[model samples]
Every structure is written in structure tokens, then in C-alpha cells.
Target chain A: MALRLTGYDEVMAQDLIQSTWITAVRRLESFEWKSTLKTWLIGILINVNREQIHKEQKKKETEQVREDTMISKSGTVSGYDIEQGLIQLPIGYRRVIILHDIEGYQHKEIGAILGIEEGTSKSQLFQARKALRNWLTDNSNEE
Target chain B: MKSKMNHEELTPEERAAFDELSNFKLPPASLEARVINELKNQGLIEKQKTMNIYLKWTASVAASVLIFFAGSYWGKQSIENSDIDPNLAYMLILHEDESFRPGDPMAMFEEYGNWMQDIIDRGIKITGHELDNEAVMVKASSETHFGEEATERTSGYFIVEAESREEALEIARKNPHVKYGGTIELKPYVVR
Candidate 1:
């Protein structure tokens, strides 16, 4: 997921994941088990990915909105399919959709992960779904 | 991590799409192993990265305690020695000395290719395309502009990653150009 989120830059994702592991290893004692460990780890991954996206955006702006991520490394999300459509979503919307829809994270969890309001996360997911539907229609017309 | 965690049902099309995406492939086995191995090798929590925020407070206190000793100065140098800076990108600027030629043409080029292959294997090189010797230059200025200026000539260039000008020089010197009459110029590749 970290690789997918980072436009399929595996090395970058691996670096981020390694940092996440270091963080997790250090804070293992503090974990109260309120959420499943997987959920916690996913949260860490999401934060790392978000930081990377922020850095890339700061460096390259819109130029970093990589179509190759979906077009190239996307597996089942191949071609002009809905998965392609999802990956094409703006980073914010894409994150929201992936977390809430695909990864079963609630808006509240997403808000924490993304450092956004829960309401913002909810609305982003709504907008993301709408965009995906629109993209599907546009792609079909192009076909 | 287990990825299938659907709770809210979406519209049929949305549901299908999301389900399809849930089967997203994991990163390669080697990447996973590298991460795990690095974490273990670093001793993750047991090493420099302390898990406790409270320890950070103590670290600040410890930092103050070191100011009285000369060891505080050594600490900065220690960090510089510890890790390679991965941020900066370096460029090997190929200065095409138009008249320069090695005695053995094939041997020089083969040596150049071998050096480049080593750099490529290290993954430092981004990409490069060497231009043909055929030259053309365009000039524009406040005065009358001239076409096909003679002074401008560059053979080719390669971009690589290095922390400092010295390091860039170290990488650039390996270019077979240095041994022959051709010149290798090192420059920091600035991302605009």
C-alpha cells in the first residue's frame, strides 16, 4: 500500500516503511491495543506516505501527479479500469477512498491518519467516489 | 497485513471496484526482507531510535550536560560520519574538448563504458544520453545574434546522486574522459 501510495517508487516506500518500523519498535510499550496492531501499523504507513506526498508536492507540485503509478505498476488496477480511476484521484481523495472503502478505515481513523477533520475525510471519500464514477464514464466514452 | 476489511457496502459498481483493488499486490519479497533486515540490523528500538518520547526529554538534558566537555563537538562529527546524505543530486558535466582524442580509441571507450556500468550498478546514475560530435549552437543577446557559434560544445552529461562537490568530483574523475584529453566537470544538479 505504501508503494502504491508513493506512485510505485518501491525504494522510497521501503525507506518510509523502515522508518515506520523504527517508530513502532520504539513505541511498542505505549500501544494500548485499542486498535488492532495492523490498524496501528497501517496508520504509521499512511503517515509516512502522506509525508512523502507532501515532500514531492512541495518539490514538484502538480508535476508529481504521476499517471505512471496507475498505468505502470498498478496490478489488478490496470488500464482504464475503476482501479486506474481510483489511483488517478487527487492524493487526498485517493487516500480517503483507499482507507475508507478499500482498507475499511473509518472516517475518524482516516482523519487521525491524514491529520484532517473527520468531516473532511468523509466528504473527501464522497467526492472521491463521485470522481471515480465520472472517470469510468469518461474512460468508457474514450473507449 | 491483512487488507480485506470491508464494513460499509458501496453501490454495486463501487463495491466491485473496491473489491478488485483490495487484492492489490504486496511489494516484492526482496523489498520486505530488506526492510526487516535493516530494522533488525539497526536494532530498531534498542539502538539510536529510542521508542520513548520521555527519553527525548532526557536527551535534551544529556545534550546540555555535554556542553561542558569537548565531546559535544565530536558528537556533530559522529553524525556526519554515520549516514550518507541522500538528498543532493550530482551531475557529471562532460566537457567535449573537440580536438581531444585518446591514442587507442576502442580501449578508451570500453574503459568508459565499464566505469559507467559500475555507477549504474550502484544505482547512482539517473539517465544519460551522449550526443554525437556534430555541433550546432544558437546565440541571442542585446547585440546582433549569431547562428552556429563555435565556442559552445558539450559531448554529453550524466546525473548522479552525491552529497557534496568533493563527492561529485570523486564520481566524475572515474569518467574515462579524465585519462584521455576530454575533460569531466562536476556540477551539482539543481532541481528547479
Candidate 2:
């Protein structure tokens, strides 16, 4: 999950998981069991990933532009292509699509995890799916 | 060109593609080690023992002397009396720290195989398995802690047949783990 969220960057994904574990252990007493442990850990991971992105905002912007170009040239729609398409998605769209479609989390749960409004989660999912579909269909037409 | 489809529902191909992403991928094993190390550094997990080398040497020598005398007395008694059960089971709990010399993994396996074969050749039944790094400590307070809780982790264990407690200690002393600077605690299983 962290891997997909971090656009398959292994080093960043590993760092996120490590940070999440440390944070979870530190704040274990505060965990009221409102959600499952896995859900709680993922919430920490999302926050950690967001913090890291803020820290590396300039580098990420450059990488995102490069990834967008690669996605445009990528031909055909397959599982691997879909994953590439996800990597090229805007961070917010990627998070919503991954949480909703890939992880099967509902708008309510997604809102809780991402700290967004339930309606915002629903709208983001619609926009994310639409964007992903357009990218996939465009690639398919090219092939 | 795009197909007319509801933006809320993913196309079947897109759903199938998303399904592929849902399959869990295992993180690198080294990442677990790194996390545990960082936890230890932060004082969240117990650190390994930092005993003086001389103190460790002294303790090792004292334990050897005690084992030698106990083994001699028991060996003499067992030979004199045939009533002693010759096949008592004892569990050898192997504890390993940073001092443990697990050189090449293949060589370590070969060494273990030879050790087990030696016991089998002596007509002793033996079984054991090496433990993984992951551990969860569940407490009475309904709290669970993950990772190592102590300095030395239980690397593995072996249950072998011996004549008595002293004989079990002697067998444990000869284990490859002892030669590799690891500790083995001999425990007799209670028969009900």
C-alpha cells in the first residue's frame, strides 16, 4: 500500500513504513481502537508520506513532470499500464483512487483516513476514475 | 476517442487492473531489521547486553566447571544403577546475541545438519527450528508489543533425549551453538 501510494519508490516506501512503525509505537497508548490496527497504521503512513512530499516538494514536482511525459508515451491499457497510469496521477487523485478502487475503502473510511470531507472523498474518486479512464483509453487508441 | 461510461464506476478493464494492485507485496526483509535497529537506538526496544569481556569469560569458565563436576557425578551414578531412565527428554533453548558467529548461511545450515546427525547417531531423538525476527509480546493488560523484548532472542530450540538433567546439560554443552558463542538453557519436560 505504501509502495503504490509513493509511486513505487522503494526507498521512500521503506522510509514511510519505518516512520509509521515508530510513530505507531510512540502513540500506542492514545490508540482508542476506534479503527482496526491496520487502518491506524495506514493512517500514519499516509501522514508520513504527505510530510515527506512536503519536504521534497521541488524534487517531486520535477519527477512528476517526467512521469507525466512517460505516461503520455506509454501505449496500450494493461495491468502494468494501469499501475504506470497511477504513478503518473496527481497525488490527491492517486490517493483517492487507491483508497477507493484499489483498497476497497468507502468514502466514509477514506475521509477518516485522509482527513477529508466524505463528499470530497466521493468527488475525488469520481474525478480520479475519470482521469484514469481517459489516460487508459487514450493509450489504447494510440496502440 | 473515449467510451461513454459513468465516471463513478470504473470500466471492467480498469477494475481488473486495480485488482492487480490490491495483491500485497512483501517489503524487503532488511527493512524490518532497519526498523528494529532504529527502535533499539531510540530506546523503545531493549538493547543487547553490554557485559565486560572479562566478566563474560569468568562466567563461562565457572559454568564449565560446574557442568563438568555435575556431569561426572551423574555419569558415575547412572553407570552404577540401571534404574535411571536413559531416554529422558530435555529442551535446549538456544539464545543468541551479537557475539553469535553465524558465518555464511549455507555453512551454518551444514553445521546444524552435522550437529543433528551426531545426536541421531548417538540414538537420541532431536527436533528443532530456527525462529524468525518478528515477535509480538502480549501482556495481561491487553496491550501488544512488537519486536524483540530482551537482549538475547531465542534463536532456536531442540528437544533431545538424554539420561538425566546432567546428561542433558552435557549434550547441550556440545551443541554447535555453544561453540558459536550462543547460550543454551537445558530444561526437562514434565511428564503428566
Candidate 3:
């Protein structure tokens, strides 16, 4: 609808028509065929978009790491940290304690399997673990 | 997962910023439907990949046709009215005699304007530029030049369009400079 006229009648609705034509023409002209004999230009643009997406993915991965390592006391420990911490624990001690306390097993199995009183087996193990934890912290402070 | 922001433990800057936030307030209920309708009317905005090549091609062809006809019309008009030929040139060489002074433009100014305008109107003269009268001649190792003392330099020149050598001379004869005891040197100007 945009007509490019060399000359026009000034007496008509010239200003209005000319302004409308200019606006429409400009918008239409924006859809230019930017093709070239060298196809590498378009290839580079695609590569740039790909690089941007890769960068965004890397950023998201970093955000995930931050989420896992965030310092909080609201019982949000990462599984990786738990695995590493459990490795430092004595094999039988933590195994028995985890089965009884963490896994909510009966003390009869703690006694039969690990040789201790059925009722006292749970509480005694709990107290011993608390004492060990305090001793570790104290030792750390001394160091 | 990391915990969301706990406002109770906010830093002073964060707490102050949070305190300034307004309570939930709804927009005017009527505006929501209007916005939805507007969105529906426009639909999705998208970029076009290609232009209508057929339309542009047609326009180009039409432009070529218009140019051809328009050029022929003007070409014919100039040939009939002005007797212009590409190979021809009109040279008007100015000559002043003993009675002519260099600085009396008032006597010839009006007549020169009308004279030059007539040539332009007839489409005979495309353009002309006036030159300063300074001529140099090398005599042995020294050079003799036109200055205040050496006043024998040709005055000025004009180029006009003509059909033949005789017609060019006729143009030179009618020049305003010739009326005041001045002669014109007509010559053929070959343009490469």
C-alpha cells in the first residue's frame, strides 16, 4: 500500500499521505533479503546463538551447584556431602547406628547382631555417638 | 534445594527494600478482558523471512518501461528545439581592443545576464565559468606573464551548443563582449 512517488500534488492530503507512506515503507523495507554469496555470515550467527545457549546451560549447572552447597540448618544436606562425611565414620559404629536410629529399626536386632542390651542398645549408642561428635569438635578446635 | 528468602533474617538493605513493597492490589477488573481481546486481535508477532519477489520484479519492469519512454520523449524535444548533438561543441573566445577597459562591468552586466539566459532558455549552454586573465610565456630562463602592465590576455570565454562550425561562430559574433570593440575567436572543442 506504500507508494513511492517522485512528485505529488501538494494541494491534496499530501502530508498525511506522505507520512503514512514513509512509515509503511520503512516497516516493509525492514524485511530485507540479507542474503550473500558468502554463506559463512549466516553460519556464524547460528554459531553465536548456539554459544549463547551453551553459556545459559553452564550458568544453570552452576546455579544447581550453588543450590546443593548452600549453607542452611533447615535439614537440607546434599547427598554428596553426606556420603563424604559418612566415610570418615567408623564402619560398624555408623552402620549399626544408621540401622537403628536413622532407619528406625528395633533394638532387638541391634543387640542380637551387635551384642548389646535390647532397650539400652538404642540410647547407649546415641549417647556414645554424641560424645564422639563433641570430642571431634574439641579436637578440631585444639588443632 | 536451596531455601527461599527468609524475610526475618534479611540484611538491613534488603529489609528496608522489602518493607517498601505494596500489599497485593488487583488491577481494574475491566482492563483484564480488554488486554485479552487486544492480544487475540493482534495474534502472534512474527518476522517475515522473505519479501514478495514477484511484486518487486513487476515494479522493476514497470520502472524500466517508464524510464525508456520518458527518456525518448525528452531526447526528441531537445533535438528538435535546441539542435544539440553529442559530438558538437560551441566555443566563444573573447577579444578586447585598445578602447576596452578591464573593470567596467556596469556597462555590460545586464545585457550579459539576458544574453546568457537566452542561451540557457534555448538549451544551447549547459554551463560556463568565467576565468581570470593571466597568461604566462617562458622567454629563455625568464617568464613574461599577464599582469597590470601586460594587458594583452584574452578577456573571457563561453561554451555553447551548436550544429556546425559556422553556427558556433555566429554565437560568438552575437556575444555582448563584441559590441564594445571586442572580437571573438571561434574554435572546435573536441570532447573525448
Candidate 4:
């Protein structure tokens, strides 16, 4: 059985689900039966999320220059132990890690969702795991 | 410690680590209720969009009706401000070729006359003719030919039934003679 979402994971998942509902409603007429309705709806939500993140990044660049300039790669911030680190990773890596680890989706399924090859999805997952493991190691050293 | 034993199988190692890491109990049960309520609020947005579209359509229909009556009122006012004579009609001379045709000056006039006949048939009385460019020269009448005051050159003429000079000029501009640097001089004719 899949684990229940909690903390920032639950919050972020909720945010994504809400945004997905709106996209589904907006594009309901174009829904062909080529793929499952959930997958089609989730695809639109992914694109929407990408656009929102891009706009947010642009806004952050202008208003909060410091926060946007250099990403905190060390990933040991006080509030963000692991949950925030998962969310804070760049979108490409986040998609890989979230699908494989948190969402319990197969690499092939992640590839289908992200429009990437299965091998590429596996590679991305490996990289994301390495980055997270490094962040976790660094976090434990501070303790 | 179990991670070492499970190192050969990356999946079990990662799963065990994730399970151990998320051991902390989740916060209050009210958070799920709050999220579900937020979802309901999001659904109401579509209803608001439909209402907006209906409001816009209502405004458009109202404006169209208002414009219909407003146009009729404007038309009546314009007609009241102007008068048209019965006998006087418009003349248009069109030269289609680079150089005017020899004796075909009456051809374009015939076309104009045919067009105006339809307007006349509709009870809006108007006649139109084409005048030859060479024939439009200031001509002396039989009596004036022998007079000392006979003029050799005069602008072309178009007779249109109008209450005033402005209205006459407005109608005269549509005449073919008004094109190609030709001037249209209007004169009121009394039909015996």
C-alpha cells in the first residue's frame, strides 16, 4: 500500500491536485479517449504548474533578488529538513524524485507522464536520489 | 543499520529509509477537511464565469436595441433638414479608357441612367446621365453665339436635386466627372 502524504508533501500534493481540477475543467471538451482521463488531466496540470513556476521565478527575480539568485544547494535550512528539500529541488529533478519515491509510480509511468524515455526517467531518479542523499548526509552532520 | 543489509537491493534500502524518515505522526485531521472545502470553493469559479458571459450578452442586446431606435431618429432629423427638387437630376461622365472614347460619351451616362431608374422605381425620384468631356465645354446658345459676351470655357455641370450647396456637393462627388481633375458645377434647372 502507498504511504499517506504528510507535512509539506501533503500540502504540495494538494496544491497540485487543486490546480489539476481547474485545468481538467477548462479542457474537458478536448478530452479524447486516447489515454486515461486522469492521465490527460494530470498532463495539463503539469504544464500549468510549469508555467506558474516560470512566472513565479520571474516575479521572484525582480522582487526578492537574493532568494532567487543562488539556490541554497546545501539544503540544510532550519524549517526545511527533508520535506522542503524535496519541494525545493528544481522542477525537472523534483518530477523524477516525486514520481519514483513519493508517488510510488514506476519509471515507465513517470516517463509517460513527463514525455521522457524510460531510461531518461531512471537516470533522473538516480541523480535525484544522489542529491537527496547528499543533502541528508549534510543535515546529519549539523546535528 | 538495516540499510547496509539492503544495500544490494536499492529499492528496499530507499523504501526503508523513507518509511523511517516519515515516522512522525501527521498533524490535525482538520487539514484534510480544510483542503476538501477549498476544492469546493474552486468549483464555484466556473459558475461566476458563466454569469459574466450572460451579463455581457444582456448588455450587447440592450445596446443593439438602443442603437436601432437611435438610428431611425437620426435618419428622420437629417431628412427634415434637407429638401430635394423633383425635376433636377444628377449626371455622371465616366471615361474608362486611358483616353476618352470618340463618341461613346453617352455609354457611361446610359449605365448611370439605368442605375438611377431603379432608385426612381422605388419612389426616390432621381435620374442620372453621362456627359461627354469634350461636349461639356462652355457652349454658346444659338442666340449667345452671335453675342459679344459668349464664353469659350466653363466647368462641367451636374444637376442634383438638393436643398443646399452642401447636399448638392455631397451628391455631386459620386459622379464620374468629379474624378480625373474634373470640376462639377451645379445649377438649378426649371422644367417647363
The numbered model that scores best in TM-score is 2
Model 3, B1-192: lDDT tens digits are 112333123235422332222111222333323432442354311111232322232122221121112111111111123333547866677766576543223224334545654554565743332334556878889997775344455755556678778767766776666776667788777778
lDDT of 1 at A69: 32
Docking class of 1: incorrect
Candidate 1 scores a chain A TM-score of 0.71
- Lowest summed lDDT across 10 adjacent residues in model 1 chain A is found at A70-79
Model 2, residue B161: what's the lDDT?
69
Worst 10 residues of 2 chain B by lDDT: B70-79
DockQ values of all predictions: 0.10, 0.18, 0.01, 0.02
Docking class of 4: incorrect
lDDT of 3 by residue, A1-143 (tens): 00001011122212222232223222332322232101111122222323433554421211211222222133232323232232334433444443443333456755644455776676655543453333233323231
lDDT of 1 by residue, B18-89 (tens): 555555544454653465467558764234334333233212211212211111111111111222233577
**Residue A87, candidate 4: alpha-carbon lDDT:** 43
lDDT of 2 by residue, A1-143 (tens): 67777888888888877787677655554555466444565687788888889896722522453324333334334667778777767888888887787677789989999999999999998887777777666544343
How much native contact recovery, as a fraction, does model 4 achieve? 0.00
Positional deviation of residue B126's Cα in model 2 after best superposition, in angstroms: 25
Best by DockQ: 2
Cand. 4 TM to true fold: 0.38
How high is the lDDT of residue A100 in model 2?
81
User: Which ten residues in a row are the worst by lDDT in model 1 chain B?
Assistant: B71-80
Candidate 4 on A16-46: residue-level lDDT in tens? 4445545554454454434533345445556
Between candidates 1 and 2, name the one with more favorable lDDT: 2
In order of appearance, the predictions have TM-scores of: 0.46, 0.53, 0.30, 0.38
Q: Which of the two candidates, 1 or 2, achieves a greater DockQ against the reference? A: 2
State in Å the error of residue B120, model 3. 1.3
